[model samples]
Target: MALFLNTPKLNYWIPKLIEESEEELILIVPYIQTSKNVLNALNKADSNGVEITLVYRENKLSDYEKSKLLALKNINLLHHPNVHCKCYYNGDLLIVGSMNLYEYSEKNNREMGILMNRIRFKGQETFASRMVNDRTDVFDDAILEIREIINAASLEKASKKAKQTAFKIDIIKTEEDIVRDRCDRLNISFLNKKFRTVEYLDNKWFAQCENFFDKVDVVFQTHRIEITFRLEQNELYNLYRAWMQTYDLYEFHGFKYYWNKPDQELLVYKHDNFDWSTDNADCNKDKKYYEGLSTIIKKYRKITNK
Candidate 1:
């Protein structure tokens, strides 16, 4: 059975939901302008070694909120553009509501929620509520829906310190990348267009291309690192668009651009200087590689309306 709750009760129980967690705390709430009490509860939960997963609206977090949230330990922050429901669950106890987890929503808005315990329900049977009757109304079904939402959300890395401590490991590869190499000669451009532009680098919009000009901004923080990663995809298109005015300068994404002297070349994509002798087998391999690469480049041009 689920206990109905109003605004005051919602505030009281949300913190309680977080505080009572012995292992994991999952909060799927959008627009997280957390009140002081709620923020303190989250901080304390982190101190106690509770694994917390918080999902909020994408690009909605201000730098202040980010600084505060990123400072915590044992917490995973995620972003979902579509998340609007408010749910707080600690494995067994669940709160489903018309809440935003925003400070004003709890203090001023007349919000409502239903508190449920999985322990109260026996087996796979769903307890019935007035005005609703179905398999979906069960407590287990609600849990499943929450899990689906979390699965669809993208993991957002918010820590500046983590980004500053750069990893020397570059490139995104699967067993597929390794297998393809076993069957063909490889180049930086091969993985460059094949992985970074065509598919998501890591199923996230942002991905650093494996080698080729990737290590240039090993020190520059801000958006420079992210922009340089994107330049791999941009530079590939620039090769045909004459966006380059000089070897050192280029335009990106329809904007006029220039290279910062401080942001000097960390890495630049250069084609193979291999001199090919026109033997029959060598000619065949060269043509095959060119055709394959040209196809990918053409497809990217179509997708980007270049």
Candidate 2:
């Protein structure tokens, strides 16, 4: 175990802690306001599939900071009303100290902390017993008891947050249900909504019915109708590509090639097509389009399981 005293340079160690995280990262800080470099590191850690749990006080995070933090895909932000513990830890290591993870603390304040090397007894003791601190090995049995106490505090905060999230999700689902119900009334099979854009996907193809970008269309228009088929599977895709090449086919359901790229590319397709213009009008045409697409999907599905 080592100690770092009056070290504003602790910001440098933050990145190291985040990078070294193997399974999970637990951070408890009262506030956070960090640089883009630090943010990028956190984003990179999230992209690596690390389970990150950040506990902080509410109202301490600014709107801009909150937006940036929320953008991370795999981070769980927990709000505690008066949390003051500034600790960063993972399964193998524990860093507990007076650091805010803020740019101001790194650049301005004198902070201090101790980094404890966790002792593990893999395959000998149970996973719970294996997690006891090296320094606290004398009271190894007490580790679980301490965790239980901490977990109760953490769970209380988590429950409150879960309620808020559940409420918001309920509102969103209710809105989607209402919209889907109305679309069903219009004799159209409604697809899932993503990014405020409603899509229809019953025909084994993707269709963008409405985009969040166009407010006028979202408010008044029932359907915007632009269908897309992803030639993602290999066998069926190869067959379809060969057929397209043989027939010199360019258009499908009044939609054209949105892109034509090489197979080596991650999103490459033999002939990717979608309709984005005036011709992709609602209801009857869309129904006809899906009906035509159903034949192709049936043919392809016969050859490949997908």
Write down the TM-score of every candidate: 0.46, 0.43
lDDT by residue for model 2 (159-178), tens: 23345554121111222344
Tell me how far candidate 2 lies from the true structure as C-alpha RMSD in angstroms. 17.5
Q: lDDT of each prediction vs. the true structure? A: 0.55, 0.51
**Candidate 2 residue pairs in backbone clash:** none
- In angstroms, give how far residue 301 of model 2 lies from its true place: 60
- C-alpha lDDT of residue 293 in model 1: 33
Candidate 1 segments exceeding 4 Å error? 120-137, 158-306
What's model 1's overall lDDT?
0.55
lDDT of 2 at 91: 54
